[model samples]
Target: MKPFTKLVILLLSITFFVSCGNADDDVNFRLNTGDGLGKGKEVDECLNLGENDLILSIQEQFTTLPGKVSILFKVSDSDQNPISGLTADQFTIYEQGRNDDCFNTISTSESLARISPNSQVFSNNTLLVLDLSNSVLSSSLTELKSASISFIDNVMPDTAQESFKMAIYWFDGENELHLLNDLTISKEELTMAINGITDDISNDPSTDLYGAVIKSTDRATELLNASTQGDKIGAASVVLFTDGTDQASRFTKDAAQKKVDEADPNISFFTIGLGGEIDTQVLTDIGKTFSVFAANKEELETTFNEISTRVSERANSFYLFEYCSPKRDGSGENNLAIQVKAGSKQGAVQTKFDATGFTGGCE
Candidate 1:
């Protein structure tokens, strides 16, 4: 065969194999193209490239795409009732990425209410890293169960479009990574998985808090890369429930904390120190690695409730406003001012925004 002819055939064969192989692994590269002006049904459907576009040397800037925005939240109200039927215009979001107006502004309320058309991954994955070592199991178990049920029942509403992808792991004896269920909104399934856990069940024959926490999130890091969204997760976070002691494990508490921090700065590690035996120093360091979190049991439940509520609020609400030009003499980063505008004719531009920098980014 002539060299040119042989090369042509070889290229064709490789292309053919890649096109039809392992559909699941086909990372949702599908670029959604439209005028960005909210158009017809076609605009709402995520686009899968066609043979015609392929030949045109079409390039999709999804990775370098600066406008992509993402946030994971549930729904609730001041009284904590599940708020339903939100619209895209009701909320606002401001985005900032490293080293880059890499900033983005868009109305996500509609996307939040319904499933985002552009996103292939449905569930926003969450890891509930628990400490089940016998050392602190008795006191923390009950609270953990209550929190787990509340999390499954309320925070993660079982729906076909969106839900929390959750896993429950603990270190009771040896390392116990209980059930790492794939992202699903099945209330029954989640409840069963969370409550079915028995500290008695061990991944090994001995105690393993550090082992379980470290390993669970390590696995989660890999999973979140293609986290349900079928894309790389920018802010994958964790809701850690632990007493914060490392009596048994292949890794130490410091090692686990370092790993998690480097894995995802957005991984919010919220700990629940159930008893005095709970190691506050270790957990505090863990939580501090991500964001400011409570350190004691009295504060633990409050923190859990607060964290859950904030996440839901983020889901249900939106921030709406015109971008203000940054000051010429000031630093590139400008502190934004946001007010509820609950009532018209509110006094001077009230400074409603706080150090947390809205959306609970924790400044």
Candidate 2:
């Protein structure tokens, strides 16, 4: 028989067999036609896949279960715009050992990332420390309250994650560091706490700015430590507002600055200074992450709002990605490479994880 006639017969026979299979069978099949040159292949060779230009920025990753790994990442195009509308099938995972130079692709069925949208697994905490000394109260008490309320409104979104919380604190010349409100997720509670601040609330007229800084940093450190031990990721931001120098001098400048420097790297520090009496150099040194200054009471609201905007953006940018691992318990340490494709754009990122407990089969 001629070659064309034989090919026709073979195709017909295969179609007949598939049509006659049992209806309850769960198996699926596909036919791959050869390239024009007759080199049988599943992919088309004529299509052009230009240079890969996507950005897969992986922020944080962890192993949540015996065989599952979770990653927090962001996807952006070459122009830096966030890439959306991507499905789980668009990702390909490859695995290799520490000593291997080549990566072997894991099966799409076994190692695909189950992309969860807008899932914030990490915890975020914010400490708002205010100076309630005579200097600030006599000059800008009303303005201060307005700014504080605005900051709370901006930071706490309508659909905030359960892990997001904020605390309010105030300090004066007296050694006591008053807690206006403990860490909470309720906007109403925070607003009520800010409204309660008044000139008569402070017993001393002096400003113990240094003491407040030390206490606030210590509180943030404790939170971070507790969360880590509880197997939860924790991030804290300490924003202190002051309008004058440390007049009480209860704690030395060196002691206060040392506490900030020794703080956990995960905790961010932001300082807002109002009026000309504030020591710009000292506030700048204290605000390790960010600092803003207001010439007078009029600018206080704007300064607080600026800091609030930045914090909100950072919180929303994070993501969580999880996948099952092909490695078994005794596979030792291995490397992971993830590739993403959207339209014709593509990019890749690599990370390493220890497989000491990577056992069991995924469901």
Candidate 3:
């Protein structure tokens, strides 16, 4: 696609999440194809206000302001290796600053992540970045395919599996980064997409992983931020699989990482390196705040299984910490020492330090 044309697609895709159009239009601008488009809207024919009714426009609006909180944690077992597979049942959750008038009350005192009792309205879609750089790697992609099938079968809740989709994109081919929509929800279709995976090294047509990651993450942000059915949407992590480094990307690693962090503060990232030439350190650092793995298969099967476990539990429970100041102008240097303890574990992140900027009424 031409650069200008691709830009148009990118902007159109971003429209799914961004609040656009006003009362006159029926649809909100930012939309997530993965999350499904909004159904039709009810027109407010009566512009006049009544005791219980007010005629407003159709476009969506952002009513909530950004909540500020810093979270930090350290994962360790008795032997000090980061452990996985524990469910929400195994931990305790807590919040500080209850002494001040901010939130209603402390939910718990143990500092574990609070699992919402409500049915999850979110989707955890994984966009698989398959590697097809060489013939041997192409064969290995089949193993990856088998692993992918097993992943869907084991990890996803049966009812939501159709909603929890996966997209396939292979590097170094005629259409190297195209989304395999047929494979998005079907194991059979995924198999077909993988079966046809091949490596392309032509000069006129090329592969650029940086561009792909940027594009994928941009798409993901839209999916997460979209609102449907009068509620906002959410997503888990992006699991990336690649056998090689960024050989032809338009953007640098720093730029991509910054973009991701800005888009969604809570979205986790994970990666899988399929072969020997993969950059283990780069992948590890890329997901430094979240999770990352790059390995060859003497132990990769085990790695993938562990990846499944992490994602499953994370989908069930997420940690949210909130800290706030007292009313409008009541200011004293608000310094807090907060800690989250799970079993015998202890973690503390520096909350906002001395500040005096809130001149208006606190929420």
Candidate 4:
């Protein structure tokens, strides 16, 4: 064959292989083409996607209107570690009850929700409540500060988006929760607040651990409630650290426990105790979500790191999956499932969404 003809043939062969590979990977759909392909009825009706990523967990699912549903979920590895950097192409949404036995795949272009590269989707608020009692200041103040700074560094990303914020509060003998720093996304600011802690920051050195729990939980609950009322999704993490028991007795233990129990589930509570001075049972009850104890000051950082990992993972794990549903009110309730594929690994989850109020056509 002529050299030019040979080159042309090679190019054509490459293009054909590439096209086949893409079709094997994903079925791309043009959402608004107004053609039969864009009308949501052209793709394969397969019920399964072979294998799926099993580490995904769905937390909440709700529909704002007809033909649209939003899901809040988390993705983790086999060891239950949060997985990040996933994109919309890695997922295939299927709906069964809306149509026939075959599952219809929601187009990637129609997926409005995705795992953000930044922390935008995960609007997280964290509160660090410290007990600045004399007992803690006299013995392990430096260790506490170091451990706290480590936690802030681990949890707070380098570039602060509007989605993530942190605040610091210190409690002495008083029943009040003194604010060391207001909510801010700056790691430097949070570190500065921790470093600024000194023995003289509070006039009374007695620990009001119970009061701190009550006040911090209340504050977290308020933040979460405000976010919800404002039509935004938000989560809060409250980490309380103490080296001794509640000495002020300004608030009863039962009151503090009740406050925590009554707090919103969106707010996660974490407690850290140093030495034997702290009541493990009390801290555990207060930190029903998670609790850690350090035998001494040297182990504070390790304990704090464990809690920080959990909080940060939980904060960052949230993934929002939004898609256009084919079902209308007449469809009643439908069976929905999501399968995630990342590289060669796969996971799947099944959930149901109501089409009771589904009205206008899906966007």
Candidate 5:
């Protein structure tokens, strides 16, 4: 090869490598300013926290009368697993005004920062669909009831909140999806409804698994639509438990899978299967978010618990962080950064808020 040709090839290779590296860095460091909620825009002048272990995706942010700023966001680890139970003390608020060279940390105590309830603007619903066909009713009714009660205890909060609720439903060979209990925040009500299921509850001997999937997806869609009225944002989870495949064949597998694939992104699908008769592939496909299996009835409770942890974490990851800003009127637009620390891992997100109207009293 000629020396000129070799030199040209080396230059091209360097250019290609540098371009790829730049693209990767853009994706790795860019923060996500969420859509579909409130006013959250990208801040080009904001500081880059650079390769943190946590991600805080700001969904909605707004300033209320009298200088209170509220930001709603979801917290997750770098691996995308939700981080729940973070208190206001874990957060450090920093603000930079037009006159300041750098951001100044605001004292949490003086600012009266708090993690308030998000019920006014956010809602989370879970639909627990159970398979009570003749096989499960006669063989695993006792175990199913126990597992369901444990699920309710683990998923429901100790104190009831209007924003969080769960509903129970069951399916058999029949063409209908029977409602065991309506959506409610009370765990006792859900537990009682599950405990009341008897062997005679399901008259059909076959399973209409596909039909249940389609119907439950429809129900979750309705719940999400209803919850998202006015300025509220909502999310739903459809959890299905089955012991066998679609024996009735009333609905085609393709139809069921398409429903799940085309469903809203905010809605998550989860499936729990028991015994050897269940099809792992179908369940895994239907439960795109997560899936768990139990080889026997004895392991039913454990599988339910595993799913419970995920559902709870997803619901608790969202936070309504509110604080009083020190910047009065004429500050115009200022940069704000929120830093969260969980053990050794820490992450920060930066955005801007306008303080057009000055205020003194903020609660």
Candidate 6:
């Protein structure tokens, strides 16, 4: 081969290898910016601690004038099961400035970092819908009431907070979704409402399961819209319990499913079915988030408790993590990463925030 041709071929090979190397680096350290409340971008510059057993998804983040940085995020395991009751002590903050090659560890104690209440920026609402048809009212009303009270006890916090609230609604053959109790933070009020349910409460013998699903989804959408009107982020759950299929035929199954499908993404649907008469497939579709079944009334409370546990975990997963940034006004934008350690598992997420006006009076 000619000398010039040999040199050209060698140059092309080197260029191709270099391009492949850059592509591999991009893939290895790719960053993901999630959507909605879990909104954050991963930082490629930060060190990878290890295989993440836990996933920290940032919902929202902001900065205060006096150098306080606030980040709201949800924690879940690799299986997507939420991890709750995590304290600020479990978190470690790292910040990277323009001059730093990587993140610098920030002292949690020195930064006055803490996990604050999310009431100012986050809200979670739950709508518990019950079936009061003839079958349920006559045969399983007592068991249903007991299970519902257990659900309330398990889901509600010991102390009430404005950010967490629940409302109760019941349905029968009638087209209306009757309100058993308005939204309240008091678990006692919810339990009392459940206990007040009597066999005579439903005059109709038919069941409007589809109607109830539609109405409850509408109510949940309204609540989400109201909660998110300002700067707050909101989430809701619709937990519906029924012992049988829809009998009234007032609404089509497709309509109910469509309502659930088109509802706000922030709203989650959970359904509980009891006895052999219920259709598991339909309930599973409606309860896209989760669905539980009980072979008979004997297992009702346990099934309700399972759903309550999930609801509570989901609500508690959101953390309002705040800390005083060491960055000054001229620092421009800095890379921030939060690592959380829970038992044997750990995970981290990274994002950027401006410290253009940051100062030193954080509380």
Q: Estimate each model's TM-score.
A: 0.51, 0.68, 0.50, 0.70, 0.87, 0.87
RMSD of each: 18.5, 21.3, 17.8, 18.9, 5.2, 8.5
Task: Let me know the TM-score candidate 1 reaches against the reference structure.
Answer: 0.51
Candidate 5 has its poorest 10 consecutive residues by lDDT at: 30-39
Candidate 4 lDDT: 0.78
User: Candidate 1 lDDT (Cα, whole model)?
Assistant: 0.44
Q: Write the per-residue lDDT of candidate 4 for residues 246-328, one digit (tens) a residue.
A: 88888899999999877775678899999988899999999876899999899999999999988888777667777767677
Report every candidate's CA lDDT. 0.44, 0.76, 0.46, 0.78, 0.90, 0.90
Question: Residue-wise lDDT of candidate 6 within 192-281, one digit each (tens)?
Answer: 899888889988889999999999999999998998878888989999999999999999999999999778767889999999999999
Arranged by lDDT, best first:
6, 5, 4, 2, 3, 1
On lDDT, who's better, 1 or 4?
Answer: 4
**Which candidate model has the greater lDDT, 3 or 6?**
6
Off by over 4 Å in 2: 1-67, 72-94, 97-101, 104-121, 316-318, 324-334, 338-349, 353-363
Better model by TM-score: candidate 2 vs candidate 4: 4
lDDT of 5 by residue, 1-363 (tens): 999999999999999999999998866553222222124433224455555677777767889978999998888887777899999999999899999877888998899999999998899999999999999998999999999999999999899999999999999999989999999999999999998999999788899999999999999999999998977878899999999999998999999999998888778899999999999999999998899999999999999999999999998988999999999998999998888899999877778999989588796
Over all chains combined, what TM-score does candidate 2 have? 0.68
Ranking by TM-score: 6, 5, 4, 2, 1, 3
C-alpha positional error of residue 297 in candidate 3 after TM-score superposition, expressed in Å: 3.8
Task: State how far residue 257 of model 6 sits from its true place (Å).
Answer: 1.8
Worst 10 residues of 2 by lDDT: 30-39
Model 4 misplacement above 4 A: 1-70, 75-90, 96-99, 106-114, 117-122, 322-336, 341-363
Per-residue lDDT tens digits of candidate 3, residues 1-363?
A: 899999999998778556444522533222221111122122122211112111111111111112222222223333223333334444322222325543222233322233332233435555555544553354465566666656555556555453355666555533345665432556556656655654442322334555666666776665556522335345546666666677666668887666655556335666766567667777675554344453555445565666666666555432222333232223434433333335555433223333335443323
Better of 1 and 2 by TM-score: 2
